[model samples]
Structures are given as structure tokens and as C-alpha cells.
Target chain A: MLIDWFTVVAQAINFLILVWLLKRFLYQPILDAIDAREQRIAQTLAEADAKKAAARLERDEFERKNRELDEQRQSMVSRMQDEVSGLRQKLLDDAQSAAERLQTKWHVNLQRQQQRLGEGISRRVQDEVFSITRKTILDLADDDLEASIINVFIGRLRQLDGEALANFVQALTAAEAAVRIRSAFELTDEQQTAIRQVLREIFPADAAVRFDCEPELIAGIELTAGGRRVAWSIEDYLKTLKDSLGDLVREQDSSQGTPTAESESLA
Target chain B: MQLSPDEQVFWQYGFIKLNATIVYTWGLMLVMALGSRFITRQLSTEHTRSRWQNLLEIIVTGIVKQMKEVGLSEPQRYLGFLGTLFLFIAVASLFTIFPGYQPPTGSLSTTAALALCVLVAVPLFGIQEQGVAGYLGSYIKPTILMLPFNLMSEVSRTLALAIRLFGNMMSGAMIVGILLAITPFVFPVVMTLLGLLTGMVQAYIFSILAAVYIAAATQGHQANPDLATNAPKAHSQTNGISHG
Candidate 1:
């Protein structure tokens, strides 16, 4: 068979029609669907990426805030610790000051008690010495001790200074021209006469010596003339010694920063 | 059995003849068109797809991908021509495994018509891409003496394509026919299977050659500038794989 020109023309036209049909119904739609799917996937991925970035930023912010809170908590804790430490120090200082104050008050009270005890002992010693000396003098002396006491009284009158002599003379010149003499025992008449002779010589206007027995005088004598008195008692000397010893004790307590009381009693 | 389906005359008018070649070609075209429409009617882009949808997408994307690999950067622009050429020849050879069917591609007229389409398409695409003067100027390259040589090469290659496809398809059918008389059963079945393999090969070769031609024509198309740079290397692979 030869080449069929009519069939060739027909086949070519058929192929072109087939090409147009396939293009219209097959290739175009599939390609469009594929393109659409690709675009959707890309958009979803972009949204996912944006969400991931936002999550990361939020996480970072949370971490930063947590760190700040931690710092604040630490600062508060440290400040509280410092305050507690300061309070502890103040309490310790208050305790120490209280202990020292109690100690100082106790020491002062102790020193006062000690000074009072020393004063009591000194008084008791003076009283015991006076009693012993008075008893010994009464045992040793008989009639002479009283005479000696009278003689000592008269002697004291004769030894009076210018002011005393005038005072006595002025008193003797008055209507009461007598001097009283006190003794631990009764005086002899001779003793009394001697005292009167001394007085008359000194005063020149009277010679009256009145004698009296006062056993409580404790082997001592006293003269009273013109409303003036002169005494020689062992109690006065004992009081002087007691006062000097008390002053010494007071001075020692003061130098040692102690507190004590000192008293002077008239004898 | 007739060598060309055109020998089967169905009706006639004065110098206007209707033949089996025209009939089968139209019937094949109708089947192709209707099947494609039905398969694409409810297409889905989801992960789950119909088997038919899967098959059609595979064929279409495979064709587009091959063209792209061969340096046709804009593959869909040439998809219609190249894809039709491949399906036509493949379907033609494959239908022969059935009884009472003769391939239209076994005829010289149909093969020549297909070759002529390729010849016409090469220039049309070239002219569209680089303009007429630039495409014509490709011939005068290196010297003016190459103009006739390039022309002769174009015509000669087109004829080679037509005759080569015609002879191979026709000879395979002829050999099976001769074997049918000599040994009726087993050898003919074997040869028929071999023919199927050969037919699929021819389809692949035809599509590849057409792609190669269009790739050369649109070589300087600057839509994808790197495609022009890589085209020659891709063209050499095409040359290596080219058969009728």
C-alpha cells in the first residue's frame, strides 16, 4: 500500500484535538491543585515559625522575672539577717550593763555594812577598856585615889589663864562664892580644905569648895565654877580615838571607790 | 492481514476514502480523552487518593519531570506536545496484545505525520522563544556554509524518525505473523510480550527525542538563565539515549 495522504491529515488533526483535550482537562487542573497545596503548606509553616518565636520570647521573659524575684528574695533575707544580728548585739550590751550595775550596787552595800561593823567594834572596845581601867583603879587605890583626884582638881583651878581667872574672880565676888568638885569617891575633909585654900588664893574673894561623891564618874574628877565646867574623863579620849579610826576607814573606803557612812557622836 | 490499517476501506466517495487507520486513530483518541476526563473529575490533593488518580498523576508528573531534567525549564509549555506523542505511540503498540486490533502506528502515513508534527514544533517553539531572526541566525553560526547542512540535517532526521519507527513496528508484527504460520502457539506469545517491551521503549525514546528538540529550540530562553547554561550537557545525555 502507498502512503495515505488523507489519513495522515486526519491523524494529525486528531492528535492536535487530543492534545487540546488533555491540556484542558488533565494537566491544568492537576498542576493547579499541586500549586494550591504547596501554598497552603508554606503558609502553615510560616504560622508555626511565628508561634515558635513567640514562645521563645515568653520563656525568656519568664526566666528574667524569676531571676529578679530571686534577687529580691535574697536581698530581703540578707537584710533580715543583719537586723537580727544588730538586735542580738543590743541584747548582749544590755545584759552586760545590767550585770555591771548589780555588781556596783552590791559592792557599795557591802562597804557600808563593813564600815558600820567597824564602828560597832570600836565602841565595844572603848567601853571594855573604860570598865577595866575603872575597876583596876578602884581596886588599887584606897583613900589616896580620892585625895589625888581632889588635888588634881584644885591644881587645874590654880593653872587657869587670865581670861579664866577674871571669869572665876568675877563669879567669886558675887553672892555665890562657892565651887563644886565632883569625884568618883567621897573626899576627906583635908582634901576639901586644900581645894578651898587653892580657890581662895586664886579668886582672893572666896574660899568655898563643895565636894560630892559621884561613883559613876569612873575614877575621874570634874570642876564646876562660875557656871563653867572642866572635865578629865576617859570616855572623851576614847571617843577621839574612835573618831580618828573612823576617819581613816572612811578615807580608805573612798579611795577604793566604795560607799560607807561616818558618824560623830558627842561625848 | 494488512500491513497498513488504511487497506481496510469502510466507505468511499469520489476521491474521498474512509479507512481503518482513520477509524482506529479516532477511536483511540476518544478513549484517551474520556478516560482522562473521568479520572480528573474528582481529583484530590489529600494524602489519600484513588488508584486511578495516583496512576494519572504519576504519568503526568513523570513526563513533566523528565522534560525538566532535560533542560526544558518550563516543562508544562511543552507538556502537551511531548506527552501526547508518548501516549499515542505507547497506547498504539500496547493495544495490539488484544485480539482483532491493529496499531495505527504500524502505518507509514501515521508515523510520517507524527514526525512532521515534531519538525513543525521545533521551529514554532524556537521562533516563540528567541524570535524569528534569532532562531534563523542559529543556522549561520561559525560560517554561512552551514546553512544548507543544517537544513539537510533537519529534514534527514525527521525522515529517519518516521521510517525508523515504521520499520521496527511493522517488522515486529510481520515476524509474529510469519511465526503464526510456522509455529502457532508459544513463540508467537513470546514475541508478543517482546513486542510490548519494544513498544514501551519506543514510547520512551519518542518522548525523549521530542523533549531534546524543544530543549534545543528554547535553549536561550532566559526565564531560567541557568537552564541555558546547563542545556548542552543535558542534550548530550539525550543524544546518548536517542533511538527511533
Candidate 2:
């Protein structure tokens, strides 16, 4: 067989050209797409990371604001509570002062009323005593010595209970030794004897008697003994003076409807 | 009998047969190698590495990766042998189109010598990676009873590789030659084209089988038992039955 060099060289050249064309058109493009896709993916990942960081920052800010607001609200509530408590204390103080003032006023009024009542009672007692003294001096003006003495004794006996009358009679008997008599007018022995007989009959046997007389007694016999005295005086005829004074006081009390005891005592 | 002068002279010298085939085929193979290298370099220059260099690197890397996957410990030590085997077979097939050339790989003596080199190198590689004791001990695992079968398989495998390459190439060449003598010219053209195709195919088959054999020998007794045990190594050895 003879060698064929031409055909072998031709085939080798054909295969080489085919390989170069396939590499240039096909493989390069596929590799470029792969690199470009990798770059785009990296960029997208970085963008997503940045967004997450921003979201986290915003959330932290919101949490911070929320915490501040909660603290502020707590402080505000506490301040309001303090103010309410202070207001409550003030109101309590005001109420206490008002109560004190009312209590003081009431006490003053009560003390004033008690003082007035005491003064009123004292005045009435003094008036009653004065009237009793006047009546006693007026009773002595009766004309008949024995009759008057008997009448006085009977009246005193009617006013006194049994124990008082006994005390009075005992007092008269004890003073009998000191008996004395005086008169502005001359007295006859028979009249004296008669007065003595009457006194002896009215008094107990051991009773002591004393007598005194003044012309100013106004035609009435006056008798005096120990601390007891009887007089018949023209002053007794002036009983209208006390009656008028009592009527005047009653009229004043009725007209003013009995002024408060404090006002009356002040007057 | 009266003879023509030309016929008498022709009969006296037998026939004028030229043995330019080997020279032409080797030349063609050199051209193919240069062409492959040039095309690869042109494509590779656009990138950081030349394509031929890159392809060479890829082949080395792929073999290494396969070796690692096959669990060989010292792939670099055996890489030269496998790489040479691949290139020789590839170039021989591609250049087989030259009219007078015959690939030395088609000869039994050459293939047997190659297979013997593989057989010898496998144990050496195994022993270098794993001591001699470990290499021998690998046959008996998971049991000692497997040692005999494991040893027999190793020897048979090398024989298979050698016989398969020789028988396939020799038969292809003989069939094409006989066809050419029977019908010259047009028929010879058909046979030549067929021979080219067959030559390339046989080269690829032989190389792949060599890889399988080397892989199995290094990987050990357990490697691909299903295909290795059932498949026939040569055409005459199989009773005219196709395994695939």
C-alpha cells in the first residue's frame, strides 16, 4: 500500500478549526453569565443586610421612646397623688379650724349665760330680803301693845313650824332677866301693869321681855328686846312705794319680754 | 505454451509489494500529534494556560482523581505508565488512515510485551504503596480461602488485555487485506475506509481495557467482579458468543 500524507493533514486542520470555533462562540458566554449573576447576588445580599440594620435601629428608637413615656407617666401619676394628698391635708386643717371656732363660740356663750343666771338669782334674793325687813319694821306699828304683841306672835307662830316656835319661846325666856322698857310718852302704872299682864299671859312664865319707844314711831307703840324689835310707824303706810317699784320692774320685764339675763345684769 | 513477455517477467518476480505503510502511518501520526497540539495551543493562548497543556493537566488530574476514587495510595508513581499507554493508543488510531502504515500496537508481540509490563508494574506499585506482605495479604480478605482465586484472576486479566488487543487488530487487518486482493480499486477503497474506522475503534478499546486492567490490578481483588469474571478476554476464547 502507498502512503497518503495529504488526506491526514487535511483532516487534522479541519478538527483544529472546529475546536477553536466552538470554544469562542459557546464557552465564553456561559462563563460571563455566571460571573455577572454572582456579582448581582452579592449586591442584593448587602442591600438586604442594610435594610435589616435600619429596621433594628428604628425598633430600638421606638423602644426608647416607649420607655421614656412610661417613666414620664409614672412620675406624673405620683405628682398628682402628692398634690391630692396635700389638698386633702389642707381641707382637713380647714375643717379642724372651723370646728375649733364653733367650739370656742359655744363655750363663751355658755359661760356668759351661767354668769348671768348667777347674777339674776343673787339680785332676786337680795330683793326678797329687803322686802322681808320692811314688812318686819312695818308690823311694829299696830296700836294695842298686848293685842299687837299677840297678833305678831300669832303671825310668827303661823309662819314658823313647831321646832322654830319652840326655839323662839326658849329665846324669850332666857332674856327675861334683862328686860327693859322705854317710851317717849308717859305711861300710867295701870297701863304698864296691863301690858305686863298681857305679855305675861302671851309669853311663857320664864320668857324675858324688852320694850323701846320713840315719838317718831308715829302714834304707834314700839317694843324692843334682844335682837327682836316691833314698831308701829307711819312709814308702814308707804307700802305703795315697794308695790309701785315691783310693778314698774314687772312692766319693764313684760314689755321687754324679760331681756336676756346677761343684758339685764349688764343694765 | 507461449508466454507474453510482460507476464513471464511478472511471474518470475512474484509481485511488486511495497512496505511504505509503516513509514506513511508513522508520518501521519506525527502530523496528527502536531495538529492536535497546535489546535490545543491556539485555544489555550486566549486563557492563562494553553489548551493542550490544560488537556494534559486534565487527563493527569482525571487519572489521579480516578485513582484516588479507586483508593490507590500512590497514583503519581503509576501515572506515567497509564499516560504513555493512552497517548500511544490514541495516536496510533488517529494516524491509521495512511495507506501503507500498520500500527505496532496491532501486533501480539508488542501488546503482550506491554501487558507484561503492566502486570509487572502493578505488583511493584502495590508493593511500593503497601509492603509486599500487605499486597499479598489483600488477596485473602475477607477470608483466606479467596487467595487462590484472587491470584488466578490477576494473571488471567493481564493475559486478557494482551490477547484482546492482538486478536482484534490482526483480524481487522487480515479481513481488509483479503477483501482488497479479491476486488481491487473500488473494493479496496471501501476496505481502506473500513480499516481506518476499525483501527481507531480497536485502539480506543485496547486503551480503555488497559485502564480497566490497571485500575483493577491496583484497586485489588474486589474491583468490578461482575464484568471481570463473566466477560471473555478474546474472540476465539468465547465460542462465537458476544457477552454484551
Candidate 3:
């Protein structure tokens, strides 16, 4: 027989045993290893993805912070520029005001110095004119001129009109002191007597008369009774010239749109 | 000249006997068990692995893939029985390159035992898949008049499985032995190489057929629709090779 019953039975049992052995050692372990390796690879990939996401988040945060910082710096720079410009404008205003004050002071000082110079010139000119007029009057003085001056004074007193003649008559009537006369030159006794007779004739009262000589009268004469006086002098005419000259200078200063202290006071 | 290794009995005691088929089968078993145990002892789950581990994994997975192709949806359930059958036959034929060796599959007893295992496994798996009544009812499928044919088919196919493998393996060994006697040279070597090819083909055909039978028993037409088209083709091809 080609087939042995015992061997067939033995081989079948052997085949079964081989199946068990292979299942235990071969299939289970290899399959398990492959599964494990696959799981590990999947986990590693997941971790890598998580790390990449975290890194991206961190990068975004850093960029945002950088943007914020840049914005802050720009704002600060803008604020600084604003402050600097404001300060510069302030300084310019302060300097301009200070310069204006100094210019005003300098201008005022120049005006005061010019005013002093003008006043000195006017005083010097007045003194020279008075000296020359006094010298000419002293040189030209004589008895005949003295008689004409007395007659002119008498004529001027007689020519007093309306309120002037009435005020003079009221003053002579109310006078407690003697009537006084003053002249640039000393009067002669006849001239004095003549002035006393004119005063008596004008007053028509019992009035005392007195006579005086004054150098500052400068070729003019004056009469007084109590506090009342009537006088005419070259100085009066010179005062008119000085007032007109001061007005002219004040008008010139006003036209120029800068009235100096002297011109302001003069106006 | 012995037509089967079973005839080469080493010892006998009444009804019990020892022979080259049993002994060579044990030797193959020992080699497989010990080699599997040694290589699998330090199995690495990492990417890098030993060439032996790689080779074993390829063979095991290849068997799994083949079972799946043959319409066994769950190949792992059948891997042990079907994979053992292939490895035993393939290893037995491969050892033929060694001098003074007779492959165990050349014995009708070993081939009969392997086919008996397949025959038993098919019903066992079918019963596991669909209860005992469901599996038994398949015998009378379509009509009760076909019951005898179905029973006979089961017995006959088991018998065919045994004879097909036995004839191919025994003939290859016999031809190589006879050629060695006549030429004692390169012709037998060439025949031996051709015998190896035949052995590998027989192993594939046997396991694929077993898987098909198991698939048919367990899932019937409910399984892969392509199984219906493929089963007859496999059956015809195997039949052609056996007849040839």
C-alpha cells in the first residue's frame, strides 16, 4: 500500500502541531510589530504638526508685538516732533517779544537823547538871542528912546478896551499896595513922574506909585497893583515860537506812526 | 525502486511502523520550528530588521494575500492551516537539493494527511461561520435530490487533493532518481530544477484550492461575487495540471 495509516495519522497530528507553533511564533509577533511601528509613525507625525502650529502661533504673536512696538515708537516720535515744534514756536515768540521790548527801549532812549539835544539847542539859541537883544538894546538905549517907551506904555494903557479897562479900574480901586512899574532900563525922575501922573489919571483915585528896573524883562516894561499885572516882553514872543516848534515836531512824529516819549508829552 | 517513501520503513513492531516519510516529516518540522523560534525570539518592531525576519514576513504575508485573493475575507483565520500546508510542501521539495534526501510530500500518506486537514478545516470553519445546521443544510442546497452528489463531491475532492499533490511530488522525485541512474550528470540537475518549479506550483495550487473550498463552505454566494467566476477556473486549471 502506498499509504500508511499510522504515518497518515502521525502526519495529520504533526501538521496540526506545526500550525500551532507557527501561529505562536511567526504570524502574531510580526503583525504586532508592524502595527506598533505604524502607530509610532502616526504619533510622531501628530507631534510634528502640533509643534509646527505652536511655532506658527509664536511667530504671529512676535510679529504682532513688533507691530505694536513700531506703532508706539512712531507715536512717540510724532509726539516728540509735535513737542519740539511747539517749543520752537514758543521760543520764537519769546525772542520776538523780548526783541520788541528792547527795540522799544532803544527807540525811547534815542528819542529822549534827541529831545535833550533839541532842548539844549533851543535853550542855547534862546540864550544867544537874549544876549544879542539885550546887548543891542543896552547899546541903542538913550533918553529919546526912553521918552518914546514911556509914551508907548501910556498909549497902550489908554487903548485898553471894554473888559480890560474896567478890570484895570477895578484893580486900582481895590489896590491896597502902591502901583509899581518895571522897565528893562532905569527910568529917569521925569519918566517916573510921568508914569505916576498917567496912573493917577487912569485911576482917578488916591493910588500910590512905585518904579523898578528888571534885566530879564528884555526890552519890555510891566506895571502891577496888588496881584494884578499887565506886561509885554520879547520872552513872550519867544515862548510862542517854542510852542509852535514843539507842535511841529509832535506832528512829524505822529505822521511817522511812532510818537516818541518827548513828542507824546509835547502833544 | 520504491514508489513512496512510506515503503522505506526503518522499524516495525506489530501494527506500528517507522518510515522515511514520518522521519523526514519530523526533520522538516524540527527545522521549521527551531528556525521560526530562533528568528522570532528577538523580533524587532523597528524599521530595520534581519534578512531572515524580512524573508519570513514576506512568506507569511504572501500566504495571507493569496488566501484573501481566493475569497477568504479573513485570511488570518485560515493562515495557520493553509500556511503550514504550503510551507511543508515547499520546504520538503526545496530540501530535494540535498543528496540522499526524500521529500515527505512524495508519500501518499503525508499528502493524504494534509488534504484531510483541509477537508476537516473547511467544515470546522463553515460551522464556526454558520452554525452546524446551516453548514449541514448546504449538502441539500438547491434541492434534496443533489444531497448524494454533494456528499460524494466532498469526499472525491479530498481524494483528488491528496492524489494530485502525491502524484506530482512522487513523479518529480522518481524522475530525478531515474535520470540520476541513467545520466548521473547535468540532465538530472536540470530536471531537479524543473521539479522545484513543479513543487512550488503544486504548493500554490493546493493552498489556493483549500482556501476556495473554505470560502465556499463559509460564505457561499454571499462572499465575493468574483469567487463564483474564479472558482471554476481554478478548479479547471488544477485539474488540467493534474491530468497533464
Interface RMSD of each: 1.3, 13.6, 1.0
Categorize the docking of model 1: medium
lDDT of 2: 0.53
Model 3 DockQ reads 0.69
Q: So what's the TM-score on candidate 3?
A: 0.81
Candidate 3, superposed: residue stretches over 4 Å from native: A91-159, A163-214, A222-230, A251-267, B68-73, B137-153, B237-244
TM-score of each: 0.72, 0.36, 0.81
All models: lDDT? 0.77, 0.53, 0.84
C-alpha lDDT of residue A34 in model 3: 66
CA RMSD of all predictions:
7.6, 16.0, 4.8
Return the candidate ranking by lDDT, descending: 3, 1, 2
Pick the winner on DockQ between candidates 1 and 3: 3
Between candidates 2 and 3, which one is better according to DockQ?
A: 3
Quick one: best lDDT, which candidate?
A: 3
Clashing pairs in 1: none
